[model samples]
Target chain A: MNRRCSLITILATAAALFTGCEREEIRVYSVAKETAEAPAKAASDTPTPAANAPRPQLAYTLPAGWQDAGPTPMSLANFRITTDAGEASVNITPLASMAGKEALVVNMWREQVGQKPLAEGELAGALAPIEIGGEKGQLFEIAGSRDGQTVRIITAFLHRGGASWFYKLQGADAVLTAQKPVFVEFLKTVRIKEPGSAPAAEVVKVADPAPAATAEFKWKVPEGWQTLPAGQMQVAKFAVPARDGAKAEVFVSVFPSDTGGALANVNRWRRQLGLEAVDEAGLKALVTPLEGAPGAMLVDLKSDAKAMLGAIVPREGRWWFYKLMGDTAAVTAERAAFIRFVQTAP
Target chain B: MKLLWKFFTSLRLTVWTLGFAIALVFLGTLAQVHEGLWDGQTRWFRSYFVLRKAGDVWWVPPVFPGGYFIGAVLLLNLLAAHLKRFQLTWRKAGINLTHFGILLMLVGGLATDMYSRESVMNLREGGTRFFSEATREHELVFIRTLDDAREEVVAIPTALLRTGAEVRDAKLPFPVKVKSYWVNSTPDFRAPMGKNAAPLSDKGIAKDWDFSERPETKGMDDRNLPTAILDLGEHGVWVVPSWASDELLIESVKRTYTKSVGAETAAGMAAKMAAPQEVEAGGRKWRMTLRPTRHYNSFSLTLLKTTHEIYLGTSTSTNPQGIPKNFQSRVRINNPTKGETREVDIYMNNPLRYEGLTFFQATMGRDEIVDVGRSGLQVVRNPSWLVPYLSCLLVGIGLTVQFLYHLIGFITKRRATVAV
Candidate 1:
């Protein structure tokens, strides 16, 4: 009886030890279903009246020969300025109630230029006081080399209207140096339009610009091709007829030559046609000279069902593209004609 | 039999095992710089024998005894010593209790190592979450949305994503075949006309970018993002790692669909808008995307606000360096099944222990552009989490009582000797 009782006790203890802790059951719910069923309750209850308030207007004048790229997600305003050397970009961003400080911002920009962050005492020497929008602002110019290429940056910071507005222009050293005066002039025109205030008549209206003159490039159209008016960022557009009744498109556009370099652009075009990208040697072998335009390169690639013909023309620090893409058969037949059109483009 | 009993209750064995444990901890701490925290723990603490790579070679040879081995030996020694040498008396009760507590701790540690789960829940300001994602594991989730406002989910853990393996479930309409899997990969863009290019597997964004195998990350802050290329027989899909932001997934879907549908015309491609991908599977329309593996909970938490404050002078020129002083999250927990709702403030060192889980403030940051705060809460569920606390208390009481008893006995003996 004693042995049996001891055995029973051991077994009971083992059972209790193993069964002491229980695993909790996991419950799964459809968040999407719940949200769709009760949108009002499912949404956050935090009141954000300030989020719905009307934003203050920011006004600025465009420098001569500068084109506006409109607003981007991170920038309040973006402009592309073309110079003889290259194209430079000017971006204005307003950070409202940001936790960031001036020293941090300056140091971040310094790091971008491959320079060490300045000490507190060195900041005063690095920054120059400038007048912007009738307010005192700080301007900084930094020049450095990135990947064997000389790059320059001009940055300005203005504290006004409960926000820190940053204006930065970056490009090749030569082009940035040339556009420094224009950037300074542009900064002087910055103004903050108060809420519910109308702009004075003398102020340049933010409305769309008047229709511009026709683009300078001209080319002969092939037979059965329809010429369409060019849209934003395009010099010309043509609809070419494909044998399969599907319409192919041809576009003529120009951008800064430093935009991702020639190899990257070629690879981008190749990716669109479902072709594999090539190395620099392969790209050089594939590129043929344009007959009419000297120093211009043409690339013709054909895939299973699609084909792309493009010409990269270098002129005055700008790279012009004359591209035609369509069904394989159509593009093959029109290859010579597209090349001729690109050769004739001036 | 006498010799074997003596060996089992030997204090020498305890000392040796403890020495091995100390060596294991020191080596494990050094290994963390190269192997990362999770790998180090698995290699040293969780295994029976700690192994070290034979000089840069792939072979791992046993170098030292591991935590489990030492712990098991120590537990046996304690039990044997107590059963054979300890006397059952009021004076010895404290010693017995202390030994018992240590034994409980050893067993509890083993159980916790096997059963504990850790995950992280990220919440933006005003965001709600009912699930937390696993930190070190990946899962392929197949969700079927029913018409009755319900969902049936099938999650396949990363262990099953082997090449040529077919995973099937009773509720799944078809089996999924794993074509390829990579624990760590670097994204490589293919050259359009380059020779010896990798073949495109699926008709998705992966065709444009190839993932090449890479060495695993080795740090506490970095993690390996496993990528898998799965074949659904007629259809194929590439599963890539998801970032904290869902916008990347949406943008990838948009770009992939635009290219696939022959919408690569400059105009059409430029006008593409972000959208989620939905596919009809198992007679139900399901939204499909590769996301972090989630552990669903019975309760839901909504973050009302998150605040991160830096030291007052850190923003000035005097300091010029931002040092975070405090990070906090105001959250409301709702358990619909239990009909319990409560608001809790979780901050550093002050975690909320509810429903057998502990939520601790792990990370906090602010989105500069959007001016919104984000918070990361680490959720830990360990059944034996209280074992160490109980052990410490028991040991403290036991030592105090034993010390007092010894003192009293010494004084009484001295007085008796003087009187004699």
Candidate 2:
């Protein structure tokens, strides 16, 4: 009896072990609630013309005798200039960044004009510095033959509002030469508006209820501040009255944690103020600790005309943006108030 | 016990199982021409019993013997042979080690086959992603944008969606009823007053274009563009894969409308006012679309840039016959929970392994349009990935020791013969 029992027990244990090593169970994942958010739209997906749409008045004015041909997919503004010799076309394109070296762009134009690309040493002689919209820019003029007709292209490159703008006028040599002076006058009329001024459509009063108690932090609003309806991509908006009757705005927004991180957000704010982008080390120099909120950072950036006081607070897998931006004097006056509001959050 | 031992340790059984496995692999490779790699793998290599479809009909009687059966028999034979014949003698030690290594490799393969998951992460330049999506399967996603910058997403796997199937979940505010579903389809457009023309849905961007189901394609590069007509009661919308973006659909609608009206109006202005496919329920707005099912990770990867180098003297991309010199992705891995941030370059043959997941640079292409670089990384997770390495080491060591032992014995015998 003992021998039989031992044999049966050994077989049972072996069988059990083999069965225990069966295939892994198919995983059934439940929905994860209140986690990190979806990513923001890609930088490339942000249309260049739409980026300038919020400040349409900042665009260049059409020269006299130039008919507006409207915007194209790649160009923000398109116009047709009619002359006795022939008709010329003008395209104003604003891009998020310079995609390549200046030489590559010049070569691309040369190729379009049916002319050979200039060598490295020849590039210096081909480009000349010119002033457009109160900013120094590069100008290039190339003449070539296309379809047995003399064609000319006059191109200008300008940097403004943290973006690269290209203005090109291409047509018959006679027409392009005649329209060159008018194009220069058109470039001078370009206006880059100060950041933080509300778009004309958004200047109307919009009633927005205060935030609910679902948030972990609460704050007390200062006097003479009116809450406006929070638009898309914004959590809250507050209008602060200025002595000159123009209002400086304080707004709150939030994004997924590390959604471009602190440096990218700071550079985006600087871009809004028409300032140059900074490197990581420069970002650190611009950031300071918020007085009461541990692990929170405050960034103060200013251009010649506009300034921004912003705070970035990381919490619960989300990053919050609290900013007050407007005229230099207005932003400076509200800097302490913005800091106090952020510090008083509980 | 003796009878069981004899059956398990039989050399005939091992030979039979192995031979059947070889035949099955041969037949599976031939089947891949008709069925794609994914379907062929699931039907042949992954299943316990291989079902032979009758005349291309799936719902027919099946024939016998699959990969799982052969593998199981082989495993049993190996274990039983070891138990019956294994001894601790020095002469048999090498054989024992070799057999053990082989057994480990078989088990490891089984584990990997059962548990491994593969997905792809696609990123545009300067884009970041926290999840990877399965290349073969798709899901219908309902996204609700919350005020706190977070999104509440309810995903339904494509396998569960069929014609006339009602999908209801506690997490969803409203039940979605699928009216029609097609694995592959093409949009059929006609004049508004054409014969046999179907009415358009009031919601989706392609409201004017009718849909016609097409047979699933078997070409290697062809992808199944699934489309479905779903009813949310008061609203109805059409759902297609991510390749069919809202803008593309709106453009198609505008083109078809212009053709019908025989006018060349500015379609761009009309496209701007196109209504998006959105549904309102439970005091919130939800955007519904069909996308690949995503596998979220705790960490996030940001693609700093992707570079694709071509061969010299070629204006186009690298020649199809010749490999590119270099295709690389510079990515930054950030794990806030662990407080770790590092930049790693992933390129051909060199993969980044982190948290048991291996990321391989799979392909490089443009991001929807030319001039924007996009990188595709293949992410694989297999808990048994280390098994093959260990098995190879053990097998090599055992074979070396066995060879040396025989060589020494031969030398001793030769010397003794010379003395004699």
Candidate 3:
């Protein structure tokens, strides 16, 4: 139930990212022979609607001599499409990337046209609205006569999730227009396996939180000092010890669950010692084993947030950590109590 | 007489002058939309010489504009008589700061106008500059190239050059015959020709001249003087000469490679070729350059990078268009004898100041390609910058005292009113 709840929350956030903000990207799935050559065929029994049979989920005609580009795990699909029409390239982005407004789609067009993203009225001439694949999307086109050369570019949006697939066609006016009928035909070809019946994503099991360690230490508090709960980014705050102001805090939060993982966490801390940015693996390289937890690793660092020390322990299926560290001076004075806090916390 | 003096020393002059100054600036700014920024000065700038010397009344104000000589005198006069107004308290000191800042700014303008020297120093990368020549907004130079001499520089007045195709200027090394003149310009290879060509009837500034192009070189060959590009027709036919000037001096060097008598090897160096450009008008030539106003310098700059960042997908401050988020350049500095060179890593907000030349990362542009790879640097050298600072300080002090005096007076008056 907990796992399901987590998945649902992630899904909700991803959905809101699209439906809530100024996002205009449309995810376009293409079976063109040009790229991402999946088993899907354009010549399949998928029939063209009679005038208007309420439109297909997604459909588009693959121009001649185009093959799938390659596997793109991050994209809406594993591959892409290409055409002879002035090297028109098409990629279907996933809905997770776009925040879900049509302007973002036009903004993407602005990027290509060498212009700043236009506000609604700014690109009224360029971005025309249209519906494709049963979902509303935007249409964008640009043209100019420069140095005696006339050219035109066109792009259509196919939005879903927090992402948009932009079907861009650019070239000489004649060249781009020649490919238009075929491009729209390709738009008609978009389809996914039944809605809500999507395949379950691969999952890795996670273990429960571990028992705390008993450290030997204590701290002196002022006669009456009130402590408050942190509202956001709690882990980033670490209390400072008394001296000048003598007021401080130390907090922690872990993600991807491996006690937030040991070796990587430890090395990340060491990076604060006049080191350079590193990858997770490099972080793992700087680990020292913990006496109580054999497979555990530990490290320390000082970043923009200040002094930090953390440890990583392997949990059920991932890594977890009981990391504790904060401001240099403040953490130094309260290190014993912090160790005590971590030892007794959930 | 004392009452008249009081009236003359009142805030009326200050207010009027401030309003006129703002209006002039506003008009100048609005005119820039079409006249172009470089051309903006023409619409509002009625140079004293143009009005006073030329006796042009429309541009001249019969009244007064409170510039340094006018505004300062009135202000100082008022300051002398208005001494009792300020009670001289610390509380009023803060208000005085604001006025002092303004005064300092005014004084600074006067100092700058009298002593500052603004000039153009075009240097290619890897070059250095020593002395820079100050320029006027619009002046003409007759590019005089003698049959035997290297090159002779002659200044021409633009007004005369603008009249007819055949302007007969006496200063030309070879009787300066206006072959063509253009106020604004674009390329027109369409000139009819044997050796010279005919000028086209273009309506705009770029259209006003006979257009022709030579190979785009980085040296004198490309530096053009402000011209009234004329059509000096032959006989009854006005012949617009289709030619280009390098604005350079080409002197021959004695060379061992000379194969014949009188055959010369010109010491064709860019620096040697560099000559002052002139404007020809009303049978006279005038050498000209623009003023180095505020931060604008005649030198060219290029931005190395402009990137925008976002935080947690909430707000993005990207340089969506290419206006530039920062200024960076590999500037080509040049001095008359010191030569040309560059200083890299001059970034935005951080300006490079050397000699009397200061280059600020003002904006960006490209030489030819639209929407890419160009930079603008505002170079300034005003002698009176310090004056404004001092003026501001004094005004601040005065305002501070005056404010406290008024506060006390207000309290006393309130008490009296209540008592009554």
Candidate 4:
């Protein structure tokens, strides 16, 4: 069991960590203070740029055959924007569907980052998006190094009415790390469209289970004993008639089959009481009720194993048992009366 | 003088100290009903506090028995009494063994305090490790030098610096101050943030104050508290943000007028306006960055992989989540001193210790868009932590032996009765 438990834990961890194979923080720490976007080039070394680079051209090549997935999200939708050394991407997820900055969102990110949730006084950063790659997107930036690296995440959100998209980019600020451009390229593929405007996914319907055709009826039994119908969790009951307002109840789990039936049952009851515990052979040698009116057998036993006796009736497959147990003297006096009651349990 | 031993080792003293210790813990637990170990806990208990108003105000963690303090006292008493009483017994060997165990525990605690490098090692999937870093323990302090009084005078509210702004605290004579801070400061990098109010440059200070005046304190960036914005020219802008202005804080040439926590304008789901900001004094500050420390060179670690485990078949309605198991972050360690780099695996409860520092696996996070992983670790540098481990082992062994002795005695008595 312990091994199985550990196996499950290992599987769960693997499933969680393997989501996106081994993620690492890429950070480049420099003493220089300015966020100074590295000079667009090593040269023009002297030539100062004219106000802005000619209409901000896309410096990196787009992946071949990469088509737009959707359009920018509608305004008022929660969005995120990420800017890296290369390009940038944006994602928008509808606040309505996601339940708006819910606890799950943080948890999901925590998992992605291979971290637990933020401890108290640890979540220190900014909200709202700044423009990345000339496109406006929500930007969530955290400026603290965790472990031994500085991790900054900028999330841009774009929300349409019912749905939303989010673009998240995080990594160590490295002068040279692989994630920088990959993140930017990842953002380029994201686009949103009108819901349902796209072809609807095929829907499959499943048939519902047939309802139970249950019927209710009333029956009178020995005074102080109650008869529960078949539909109730309690199938049938036969009480040892009330004496001075105090009664002991015997419950029965009834079935309709008799194969490997009643003979197997009487001994099962005796075995349960742990009072010398008889076997089917011993049961045959003892009690007298089996000339085939559904094979009945009875043996005197203690009340301590009552639950076990009640359990046996459910067994015997379809063979129902009219088992009764109570204060010995009380039961002995009422035995014949209870036996007649079981015959009508239906 | 003999009475002194009675005083220190007196039963009355022991009982009083013991009772007080026990009471202290209970009261501390109760006080936690009002205040807790952290401001978040304190804030969490705030509304539910059925206690008095002054409860939180005068809150201090209870100094009860730990494996160290009370353990020491108990051991000292045991040692003295045993030496005097059992010195004549042939069972002195047994008693010696017991006392040795206890002494070991006390010595162990001291060793732990001095030498033990107990730290947490948290690693997700693929995380790196550095040899000189240990996982465990943290400090809350602002870096600063002593003031004119020759005493450690790093005053707060000044300890609270606004983002992109330096913290300014005042001293009666000459104010001692430290600049630059971060809320969730890491081993590297700090993001700049400030209040919604105007920059401190608009309020006071010299216009030419030059420095990366951001994140100079723990959670000290962008004035979340309210304040009189000091527009000190180049000194940058500073606004005492937050709702409350406990007092006018003047440190050095920087003067920031702060108020109490005022409004709730966060994203509603925000826990509260802010955490509890206390007016503290005498707190020490040492730069504890993952970068090049005052002595050690800046080394880097790479995340190999971070793996996690969870308890099975149970969700929120069923079972509580289990601890992360086998948190192994394979790290490539680089030593600037030796000019050598080594790769080692770091996991929970296990760390890579070298030089004076130790590193433990702490936590892990992912960068989905960035395509990478991040792992947190606790770094420590205590020199003598093993003594406690040895002492504890001895003590535990002695206790087990003693308990079994009595247990066997009982069993023999029962057997004798049956035979009779």
lDDT leader: 2
* Candidate 1 per-residue C-alpha lDDT over A47-140 given as tens digits, one digit per residue, 9 for 90 to 100: 2223234555667766545677766433557777665567778887655432336666677666655778989888778889887887898888
User: B1-420 in candidate 4: lDDT tens per residue?
Assistant: 456445444666557656755754565455544343433222222222233334344554322333234434554555445534445443344446666876676555444444444443333234322323221112122233354323232223322333344433343222222233333221100111110122224321211111222332212112222223333333333322222111111110111101110111111101111112222334532211111111123565555655555555443654455544455667776666678788787777788776656777766655321345556666676665665566667667667766776777799999999999
**Per-residue lDDT of candidate 2, residues B258-366 (tens digit):** 4322222214323332334677788888777676678889888988888888677565455553547789999999988899999999998999999889999998877
Q: What is the DockQ of each candidate?
A: 0.03, 0.01, 0.00, 0.00
Model 1: CAPRI class: incorrect
lDDT of each residue in A1-346, candidate 3, tens digit only: 2434433443453343223322212111111111211222121122312211221122232333233453222123222223333344344433223334556555644554455777887766766776665566677776543334454556677555533455555555554654566556555555533234554332222222212112122433323323444322122233445545534454444333542234434554566444576676766565556545546555656655456556564534444444445446654565555544444323
**Could you tell me the lDDT of residue A86 within candidate 3?**
39
- Largest DockQ belongs to which candidate? 1
Model 2 interface CAPRI class: incorrect
- Of the pair 2 and 4, which is ahead by TM-score? 2
Task: State each model's TM-score restricted to chain B.
Answer: 0.85, 0.83, 0.48, 0.49
Evaluate model 1: give its lDDT: 0.67
Q: lDDT at B369 for candidate 1?
A: 20
Which structure among the candidates has the greatest TM-score?
1
* Per-residue lDDT of candidate 4, residues A1-346 (tens digit): 2434433443453343224222222222222111211211111122212211121111222221122233211111112222234322222322324434423444445544455766434443434544433455444443444445445555554443443344554444541133434445444443443434554322111112111113232434666566543222124555566554434567654433332455555555666565565566866565655322354544445555242222232223344555566555556556666655544434
Q: What is the lDDT of residue A265 in candidate 1?
A: 75
TM-score of chain A by itself in each prediction = 0.45, 0.41, 0.32, 0.31
Per-residue alpha-carbon lDDT of candidate 2 for residues A130-205, written as tens digits (9 for 90 to 100): 8788788889988876546666778888766556678888876777866787788777766555457654232111
Of the true interface contacts, the fraction found in model 3 is 0.00
